[model samples]
Target: MVYTICYALIFLAEILISLFYFENKFERKASKKFLIISLPTAYTILYFARLFNITVVNMLAFFVCNFFLLRLCYKAKIKSAIFHCSILLVFNVTTEFVVMLFSAAILGTELLACLDNSVNLIFQSTISKLLYFSSMYILSKVSSNERRKESPATSLMLFLLPISSTLIIYAILYSLAEYELGQVFLTLLLIGIVVLLFSNIAVFWVYEFTLKTQSRNMELEYEKQKLKSAAEYYDLLNEQNENSKIVMHDIKRHLNAIKSIAKDKAVTEYIDDFIEDFSINKSVDYCNNPMANSIVNRYKSFCDKFGVKMNIDIRSADFSFMSEPDITALLDNLLENAVEAAQNTENGFIDFSAFVRKNKYLSIQLTNSVKNIVAVKNNRIASSKKSDAIHGTGLKSIKRVVKKYDGEINMKFNEDDMTFTSNIVFEIRR
Candidate 1:
């Protein structure tokens, strides 16, 4: 009865560890009631399975219960669930094996004999659970924000520490499981094992720190590239607008002269038609600011070519406080992202509105259709781009510009309606 009680307590502790590790690391899909009922039920089943003393049955129970909870209760993919469950199982088994060896060596008894007494079993269980809990806690804290996969070689290198430690312990057990080592030797061996366990945890902490530093550096590089592109685009648009104005003035003078001297009625009618078409195709004035209008008109033409319905209601707003590069970066990225997402959807549409609110704040809102549900983390949507280096490039650029002007930006994705909306407000500076 004592052994059974101990097993139940150990299983319960493991359940808590699993819950902690998952709640912060993965997305959950079920309600609180479902989690409450399912966890206790899994705990009860796991407790009974351990009673059989069959390693295979115990392992199977552990894996299946955790796997189903991760796959059904949490939103883990099949492969991901399998991989996580296997890692937890390996950690549990390896920890228990190491603790048993430690307990047997210190107690001057055979490995199996260490479990014959409830006191010894309790001691081993408690030590094993503590080591398991500490390692997992560190791992969860370090890896909670990880979104990218490590290279195969990097993964292997990370796992090498624990794998090497486990192998060393396994060899020790196989060679001397039944032998009686002296107190001094056993004490030194126990210290070595403890250090080895901690070394594994330390590697994760160092790697996580290094990864975050690298990610920040990459984001800075991407921002530099975006600013450079925005400046180049602004210059190109400004020059094109100037050239178009000059060309239009010269062409109108020549055409009017030709119209007055033309002899044939057919030729006069063709000239009139050509002038009307050219005038109709002239650039649109989207707002009072020419820089803003240039970027907006550019995207409007893209929408026309791609058959995307675009609605614009940018009432006369002042942008004199904003730099030309800032205007280009803000509008160019916003429209480019919206167009790219909406173009892939059937009957895609983008509705954009910008106006001065109460004469002190400039309000801009954009809503566009999306083909798939976008993933949101910390109230920001993840990028749909394929490259990790350029992920969130547009949003980040917009955020930098907004911050420069003391503006506020809010983004929302309506999964049910398959639309994404961005709302930004900037206070007008005198």
Candidate 2:
């Protein structure tokens, strides 16, 4: 009775931990693995501890086992494991304390025979540990592991929790009974043991199914974000290309005016006016290719309109080998996101510098001031509020182009300084 009550209490505590702390702390799926592998392991460790002492000894072993397991789970990243496991420890200690109090209360009144008391202890420990943690595991299945369901008591999950857990309780006990024989059993016994073990962990099947669904969702979201960002890139590139063509068309008009007005005074005035106007707008930047120049100038206009300053130092952007559409598509998205982030800040700015480093590479470095902490998901930036579906596309599209030509792209955000820097290596074919 004491063990069953303790297990129930611990189960409740773990559910609370999952809700308040572990839900959104790290990558959702990775957190789920830690929770799944830890519970059975922790219970098994305490089971072994009962061989020595129930309260202090078993708990000590439980703690040591939990620490080592968490270390392995996080690859020894203590900071991350602490973020997930601390809450669990709090729940464990609390439940153990309550079980101790309950034991004192019950045993305070009666002294039992040795055989009966021993059997009682075994039953209490086994059933209490089994039912609670099994329920905790089930709760984690739909709780800690879900993508964005942060609340603990969503009616959908709360309704199913007990039914699933009760089913698992009977299943795990029966399964462990069949495997009560030692590992030496082979042939029929071994096969029977394997089947039992599989059924006992029915929750694992649910977890796997959920993970498969999650991966499919992520892939679909990636595709959607990719397609959305591709449009932005294409549009940015197209506008730049069109701007260059229109500027060329105006060159003829400039030439005719210069030809017609050969009066020295009027020619000087005309030339001076043209140079002044060109300097003020400065839309035609020659240090880079016309396509790239047009995109940068347009992005600059966006920055200026949003009260942001931009610094540009780009050169040798030879996109001749790249299909006009491809080059435009790639550069447009990269620069637009940078521009957007920068524009969101007070005193925000974007800095861009590009050059050809070696044989066939266009190297670009872009830095921007950001408004909030940016999240990194599988090397892409996304927010918890924003699903991977829309937010992951821009980064993916850039990487797709980089992969096509055998190049590299890297991004990092500095939270303390609110700065985001990205580097892209673009390859041009010979």
Candidate 3:
């Protein structure tokens, strides 16, 4: 009965720990189902293996059960599941060893002998729960909010580090269980266990720090590229605005000549064609901001070239709350993506609108027809372009700007209508 109780408690602890690690990745219903099915089965197998004194089989069954449970419940790939399971197993072993050590010290009994008492077993299980929960809480607090997929090499490294450390600690515990140790040796072993525990924490901390640093660097590099693009766009718009002024001045000078030649059908036709050709490339100013207007007009020309109809409504919107670069980057990326998607569809059309809502929020919405099915991964729109890293940067840049303003961005796809919609809302800062 004591052994059964201990096994049940351990099983519950394992389920809780797994849920803590994978709560964000898995659905609650699926997680509950996994716990219900996997826990009892795994505990039964481990219980029989322990009863038969099959130590090696017990350890193998433990890891194998966890790997499969994580893979199926979290819907993770095999390698990712293995890495997660290994980390949990290492923590479990480390906590058990620590509890055993403390219980032995308090009871003045050999480490292995503590397992013979039901009180010690319950004490160990309770301590393990506390340790695991505390450690997970600390990790969750310190970890980055961005969820990046780990590289295979990094995942393998993470999997090995904890397992190796746990094994070393377990070996020390086994040695303590087998024979009495000198004071010097016992002290050294305790120090070694402490170092191993700290080393495990350090490894994970360094890995998370590396990921955060890499993400920040990528953002900086993208910002640099965005700034360069905006600069060139502004220059082109300024030149176009200047050329339009020149063309207007020339037209004024030719008005008298045009009126005199109006009686001649051939001369009038020539003058009208020249005016039309010159004005066709002129930029359309949409909002109070010239930079935004330039970007919209540039994309409008692109849409015209590709036979994608564009409807834009940006009459009295005030976007002065955002910087010039930010405004350009946001509009440029959104329009470019819309135009690209629309160009691929027959009779494609884009609808874009920006306005202030109730004088408290800036709202922007873009809807465009897409020929291919839209794919979203990790809540971000997956780029269909062959060079994903290059083309994917646009959405990332837009997200960065939105995040800076504490705004919300949402994307929805209508399968029936074959339309993709992007909505962004930013709180107006007084």
Estimated TM-score for each candidate:
0.64, 0.58, 0.59
lDDT of 3 at 103: 63
Worst-scoring 10-residue span by lDDT in model 1: 382-391
Candidates in order: C-alpha RMSD to true structure: 8.3, 8.8, 9.8
Clashing pairs in 3: none
Q: Pick the candidate with the highest TM-score.
A: 1
User: Per-residue lDDT tens digits of candidate 2, residues 1-430?
Assistant: 4333433333333333333233323344346677676756655655556556456785556456555555644333576576446545555665444443444354452222212443233323333333334444545555543454324654346436444543444354345445553444423332332233334344434544565577768776765565566556646665756775677558747855785677677776766666455532347474546666667777888887899999888866566666644565577777878787777788998888887867678788888888877776446665555221124556656676778778788878787888888887777678
Clashes of 1: 0
Best by lDDT: 1
Candidate 3 achieves a global lDDT of 0.70
Q: lDDT per prediction?
A: 0.76, 0.57, 0.70
**How much is the lDDT of residue 159 in candidate 2?**
36
- Give lDDT tens digits, candidate 1, residues 1-430: 5445555666777776677667757867889899998899888888888889899999999998888777768877899889888878888888889889876786568898856755445546656765675567557756766565557688657666665665666565544555777867755555555455446555655775577678878878877887787778767886788788888788878988998999988888998888877753367787888888888888898899899999998965768789887888888888988998888889989998998888899998889988887776554665455321122777888998999999999877787988888889999998
What's model 1's lDDT at 101? Answer: 82
Return the candidate ranking by lDDT, descending. Answer: 1, 3, 2
**Candidate 1 stretches greater than 4 Å from native:** 1-94, 97-109, 112-149, 166-193, 263-265, 279-281, 371-378, 382-392, 413-418
